[model samples]
Each structure stands twice: as C-alpha cells, then as structure tokens.
Target: MLKVECKKWNQSLEILREEALQAEHPRTRERLMALYEICGGTNATLVGKKTGRNPQTIRSGYIDTMNRV
Candidate 1:
C-alpha cells in the first residue's frame, strides 16, 4: 500500500528512468528503478515483485530517501 510522494521529486519520470539505466552501481540502479516505477503508478508491492526485492525496501528504504532530500 505504500505510495511515492511525487510532489517532492525534483526529477521527472523520464529523467529517473534514464538515470536508472545509466547508474553503474547495482544498488543505486535498483533504488532509482523503484522510484521510477512507483512514480509511474506501480505500487511498492508490485515493484518489489518485479525487482525481486522486499516490498518494505521499496516502501521504506527507497521512498524514505526522498524524504531526506
């Protein structure tokens, strides 16, 4: 049920997708891809399934990073 707080995003979905693709680090790409998916209306659970990650990682870890920015 976790959702992305899109208002806080400084970058657009296209930018996020591009950066995710270009990201060299595996962890960084995963986080960016999670954000990109969430911003595009895919929920955390679904994104987690797609990425083979725990939903909480997307909901709390990735999304929470945005809060600190």
Candidate 2:
C-alpha cells in the first residue's frame, strides 16, 4: 500500500466506502475497508488488526481494488 496523506486522501473514499457498505459478503467488506483504511493514511498492519485480516491481505486487497477502480 502507498503511504497516504490523510488530509489529502481521507475524504476521497466516498465512492469506495459506499461500495464497501453495500457489499453483501463479509470478506468483500473487509477487503474494501482495508483499501479505505490504507487510503486514509492507516497503515496496513493497523488495518489488519482493526479488520482482523493479515497485513499482506490488506496490502494485496488494496492493490487489487486500485487495479479494478
């Protein structure tokens, strides 16, 4: 995951966050939140702890989301 500048990136997740909230599966939501947190200046390790996912999973998921979007 890239290092996020919080002030610059936090509010930019409106669309992604909405997609995350509307996701039906628990894993998908977790993946989306990992992306959200990463883009919000939260480190992947912390995001993993918060979301109960592995840090690598957070990073990979964020990258995957980025590729898709």
Which tens-of-lDDT digit does each residue in 1-69 have in candidate 2? Answer: 465333443346775688789999987887766777677678888988887777776666565546545
Q: What lDDT is obtained when candidate 2 is compared to the true structure?
A: 0.68
Highest TM-score model number: 1
- Scored against the true structure, residue 61 in model 2 reaches a CA lDDT of 58
- Minimum summed lDDT over a 10-residue window in model 2 is located at 1-10
lDDT of residue 34 for candidate 2: 70
Global fold similarity of model 2 (TM-score) = 0.69
Indicate the residue-level lDDT of 47 in model 2: 86
Could you tell me how far off, in angstroms, the CA of residue 22 lies in candidate 1 after the best superposition? 0.9
Which candidate's lDDT is highest?
1
Quote model 1's TM-score: 0.84
